[model samples]
Target: MYKSQRELKKDAVRAFLKDCKEGRFDGAYVFSGEEDYLKEHYFGLFKKYFLGPGDDQFALTVFDDMSFVLEDFLDELDNVSFAMSNRILLLKDVDTRKLKGEPRKQLLDALAAVPQGTAVVFYYDSAYLAGDDAARRARQSEITALGKSARLLEFSRQDARELVGWIRRHFEAEGKRIDDQTANYLILVTDADMVALNNEIEKLALYVEGPDVSREDIDEVASRSTGVNIFEITDCILSRNYDRTLRLLTACRLNREEPTVILYHIGVMFSELLYVALAAARGITSVDTVAADFGVKANRKFILRRYFNAVSTLNVDFLKQCIGLISEADRNLKKSRLNKWTELEMLIARMISAQIRK
Candidate 1:
């Protein structure tokens, strides 16, 4: 596990420079991250650093599917110029957010048994790659283990604050600045989609010649974005502030977000708290004990700790009732008897009242 975006960027730069300097057949490189620029940046390197003028590098290709086989790319790589020592093959979107299936497997195999004198890169949106599916999780570990020879660059997903910081860095990188008001506006508009936010910043920087970009600039240039923050929903429930709760709810419906998405978010969080509640009821005495016994996701521990504090005074009977609420909500969402959003709203409201963790 490579964990930092900067680390990945540095490794990529180092790999490209090394390939150019040593003339070694660097078999393959894996750029895994949520940042889209990694794709354009490295692919540009393949063009500028390696492919000289008048070089028709048929050996270069971009693959969105991870299942892309090394054999399938052999035709392109086989025609490699005797003059140029290595070829560039890009297997993009390997984790299958943009593409999937046989191509993903093929790409993995290419990384496993990469041909000499060729530079291949297998890319994935690491945010999606680390999602909770067991099989997907195993596939990532398998690929990392098998591609022992390939240099690995892993890009971790940016959270809300980090994404905003990235936006600030982008402006600074271009020798421009965003005004405080404009910065907040951009953050609000992009809603922490780093890729989209970066794109907007580029356009705004180009449109305005001054060092400072104003809030008005963001309104005029940045794309309208949606989707309630996962934290907002959780925080609202924890605080039990009616207006804030309804505000998030209204944001959800106003954005035309799918009820299933909201349910997925809230349900997952509640399911976690339910586990905490259940653990405490089971005579589990401490946070460390609950964490070690259940073996939950790392981030979930904070949420678990909150649950314990909230429901400390509640007895086992109330905890059982809360567990039943989550199950009922899940069942209702799965069925068609009532509107999904309404059912979720009601479930959340009820849970707040239940004082599972007041």
Candidate 2:
């Protein structure tokens, strides 16, 4: 139900803080996601917003195991907030498969009877919901029953374009500037993780002069010569020049990098490109819409604006082949028997290079 990551985090925090500030936060939450820092950041946000950055504090109980009984949750829920403040029962994901008939039924029944003046929040992996029939069913049931009383906040991952802008925002805040190539290079290296990318950019910027960051500056100032190498490989692939691709591949291997990581990055890039190319061939005018259709939710708007020209180059067939090659390479790259570098090299040369339009 939630569209973007920012919206989910902001809206959820705001609502919880409002309730906590009003002495109303109660019941349980299923907080989920693979991003450990963000998860912990949210916990801090809950503390700050509810605890008022001052004298009052929220009481929180955490349950992290599948064997946790239904009464464990209710017992905490029944407890009043310490001195007129909010209380949070944080339920980490439970193993639904492990639950037998009565336990499963009891869990569902417990969900149905969460106390009034209490809110139940679920933080979970975005992918986890697909297999979770009970969670999906519970949410659907809530929409019909709880009205505004229940809230579902979703945190989504950033698409490419927004991720780029996020990189730019970091540089801007640090009183630094970088060209498109440098910025994209940095993002590619960090795998679009804003926090890591920003930190790396700051380190790079610190090595340079005031307010002007560039590719040359990055090359000169980088201490380890390891950042954004993935972007360099991507640049070669996008240029559609086999020599460049080969050259970059050699450079990466010479640097003592993990061969599988290279293969994985290439696989991701080509897959994203294929998404655009196929969508364009199908008459989707905007990457934003296409991203939604394909569930490629990262940096979509930024990707459309910046990379549309490149994406529009490939025909649907090209995208299909490219995706197939990437898939095969992905499976092969991790194999114990194959030389990862060689397999990746063949994929780039045979599959990706063959798909080059110009």
Candidate 3:
């Protein structure tokens, strides 16, 4: 049967939960994904089923695959649990993609013969995986081999709709409410990292006495991630808010953000703005249509209005010049001996000056 990727993920989670409920802990399991929240949640659930209080040190064994020897891990698996029916072996940050030759064969053999009375979990945070195609193929092969004797699961990022629902439920659990619009706005102003989102939600719940969470509440309480800060900085540049732009640039420096990174983001923002502006000039004014054209997310579609307004004040030639300036700054930051902060400051000053002169 050919199931869609979404369907496969859903089935994997469902099967894992069923096994946990039935107390049918497998001999070996593999968790490979980018979503840390679900990964940690399932890890806790497995622990609850396999161990009791104070049993971790006795019955649980943890190893970092990078440093731990394969023979040592296999030896531990062969050993019996201390004062428990089963031992839990957790292998963290195991990127099978990097395994080769002897180590790879040893790991495959161990997976084939995971010792009795041992619950082994091979966990990897996909976020840390290398972006190269070779690494990706290696990971896929590893997952396939492990799947022969282990329950393989993957946790992917949720879409905007699911995120909004999660936010609403979380707020409700804390005796508060957040409307859909406000929830989407929250996502727009933050990274899609669930751990950070959960922390922000909890902070908002504690800070706001009212039942409803507003955009104002988010702005005041939620810590802006670097991505969010870059977006704000770009917004400031587009609006020609000189003081605000400089303030944000200072904030970036204070936080020790690299000048190259800031310049890269600014270039991206300007490029995207140019695309939206060009589309609008061609009479595509609908936000949904324009966003779809640019492959922008629903939550971020709100930025189109700002982009449109900013683009109205500037021409295509000037936007291209701004992009060129950012590129030049990036090169100077990397190749030249100039101070990073000074180069970034000059870039921003020139960008603002260009906007004014236009």
Residues 148-250 of candidate 2 have per-residue lDDT tens digits of 3334443445556556677787788888877666776555556555556556777876787768787666556543333345555655666667788787778
Better of 2 and 3 by lDDT: 3
TM-score of each: 0.62, 0.64, 0.79
Model 2 lDDT on a 0 to 1 scale: 0.60
Superposition-based RMSD of candidate 1 using all C-alpha atoms, in angstroms = 7.0
Question: Where's the lowest-lDDT run of ten residues in candidate 1?
Answer: 155-164
The sequence of per-residue lDDT tens digits that candidate 3 reaches over residues 1-358 is 8885666887989888897888776778988776788788888888887664555777778888567777787777767533346778888876565668988888777777766667888887765554556867777677767777678888876667788899899999999999998997787777666888899998999999989999999999988877788888887777778788778888888888877777776776788788887887898878768766777654456566668777777798889889899988888887888788888878888998898887
Candidates sorted by lDDT, descending order? 3, 1, 2
| Clash pairs, model 3 backbone | none
The C-alpha stretches of model 3 lying farther than 4 A from their native spots are 1-7, 23-26, 50-54, 80-84, 130-151, 271-322, 353-358
Which candidate leads the pack in lDDT? 3
Off by over 4 Å in 2: 1-26, 33-40, 52-60, 65-87, 93-97, 108-151, 159-189, 201-209, 213-235, 238-265, 278-285, 304-307, 311-318, 327-336, 352-358
User: Is 1 or 2 the stronger prediction by TM-score?
Assistant: 2
Cα RMSD to the true fold for all candidates = 7.0, 6.2, 4.1
- The digit string of per-residue lDDT tens for model 1 on 219-296 reads 677766543255467667666665687777777788787776776666665556667777877878577577666765
